[model samples]
Target: MSSSSLTVQGLAKRYGEFVALAPTSLDVPAGEFLTLLGPSGSGKTTLLSLIAGLASPDEGAVRIGGADVTYRPPYERDLGMVFQNYALFPHMTIEDNIAFPLKMRKVGTAEAKARAAEALEMVRLPHVAKRFPRELSGGQQQRIALARCLVYRPSIILMDEPLGALDKKLREQMQLEIKRIHRELATTIIYVTHDQEEAMTMSDRICLMNAGQIEQLGAPGDLYFRPRTVFVADFLGESNLLPARVTAATGDTLDITLAGDAGTAQAIASGAVLAAGAQVTVMVRPQNVVVRSAVEGSGKLKGKLADVMVTGSLTKLYLDALAPGLPQLVAAYPTRSLSDEHRIGDLLELDWQAADAVAIADAKGH
Candidate 1:
């Protein structure tokens, strides 16, 4: 199968005065897996609906393969959509459900049967073709939904939290299966999810949205390692946001002093614009912060260990606030590397490489 490209220009949707989406624009290249990620009420679903022709955009245009499809209906758009619920007809056999789309398009019985069989084989559910939806497990039912979508060979696929109902193990298993299908078919997929780990694991790029705006768009690593805004940093993963006063700025690097810790650290400025004496936020990932015993060369901050939480592979250590009116600093260390003798109330030092932190324009809260 060949891949299809999609583009949206200034897409906007509204229900009277309640704007569901606002002036959103995106260009999805052929054969790419793009995920629209956000919290609830962030317009991700509205954007997906607009693109799939389920909802009309009040402004801007939607194009598929360079042809205008802004006013096309869902069926006419030739795109497959998988919703959170499996949406399979409980009364129909799996084979019939898979062939329903082909039937709607007036495909011959023989050809439709052949295509439905192929779709079931593609999803590794050929054995369940004769079973009803109620007779199958949730994972199997979801596979049937996927087969139904593939039977018609749609140009693009839009998924709306398709695995949200499954348990953790099943969700992870489906993530790999969907990724494999995308690779084998070279299909352009636009996926929507509120799960950060799912988005990071499945997509070639992530479009992070907040309050009807695209906060940041980049590869998973880029969004995690080099967040351009405070919201992106906090939303993407766990980060230690330290308030700092910029003492000096040179090119793309800034020398800043931590407000409460009374320590200096150099961080790469996210954008081109930077001025001296500006209050910036220093974003340090929890894993990057090293918790170590006092050593001759390591930078040390005198703080008592406030709490420790051990989960599977890592131990999260919370340190007492070093500065007045500051939140407790947190650091995560691999469980294997942690010393067994350490306990709460033990004084420890935290240090990290200057280059590991990111400097961004200060915002109210994360």
Candidate 2:
């Protein structure tokens, strides 16, 4: 299938007095895989619906491959959309389900059947053509749904949580299948999901939404490692956010005093140009938080172990900060890294480098 570039300019939506999506603009290069990621009611699906012409926007326009399709109908937009549920015909065979799209556009029967087989082969499921939807597993049914979408040869495909209904293993397996299909077809794809790990695995870029607005948009690693905001930091992964008073702002570093009796911390500034004595938040990922004991170097933070939970390969340690009223924080290490000396009730110090920690505007909570 030929790929297409997608552009959304000033796109927005509203339901009576409530704003469903704020004005947003984005550009997706041809053949790129972009994911819209957020929690429920975050407008990711609403934006996808608007782009697919399922719902009309209150403002703004959408263009596919340089053609303005904002006012066009869903079918005229030439885009294929897959939903959470595999919407397949129960009575029809899998081959017919895949060919239905081609038949809708009035392709000849023989050619439609041939294209359906090709689509199935693209998904690595060429043998299930004659089986009914009930005869196949959930993952197989989802693959048939995708084959149905691919049979139409649309330049753009929009998927809204296509694998959300499957079990964990199946979902992960489908994620890899989707990525492979993208590689082979090279079509412009816009995917919507609330799963952060799924987005990270399949997307070329992630547009993280929040409260009808785009919070942060970037590659997966950039968004995770260098979050632009506190919400971006806490929402994408586990984080320990500490309120700190900025004592010195020099060059690329911001020296800050931790809240309560916690000592100083240094973190990289995020272009906000924090002023002296300004209040900011320190964001350190759990893996980045170093737990040190009496044999430590530059730890300064003193806390008692409140709990330890071991699951699989990782062990999580929750600390009750002895640094006055500072918030309780957590650190994680590989289970094999934990020693007998690191027990509950043991005093520990938290340490991390300025380069590893992030500084963002203060927020009360996620």
What tens-digit string does per-residue lDDT give for candidate 1 at 260-298?
A: 754677888886466787888888888999777645434
C-alpha TM-score for every candidate: 0.95, 0.96
Model 2 Cα RMSD, 1 decimal = 2.1
lDDT (10s digit) by residue, model 2, range 176-212: 9999999988999999999999999999999999999
Q: In every candidate, how many clashes are there?
A: 0, 0
Clashes of 2: 0
Q: How high is the CA lDDT of each candidate model? A: 0.87, 0.89
True lDDT of residue 340, candidate 1: 63
Residue 329 of model 1 has an lDDT of 83
* RMSD value for candidate 1: 2.2
Instruction: Give the lowest summed-lDDT range of ten residues in model 1.
Output: 294-303
Steric clash pairs (candidate 1): none
Error of 2 at 95 (Å): 0.5
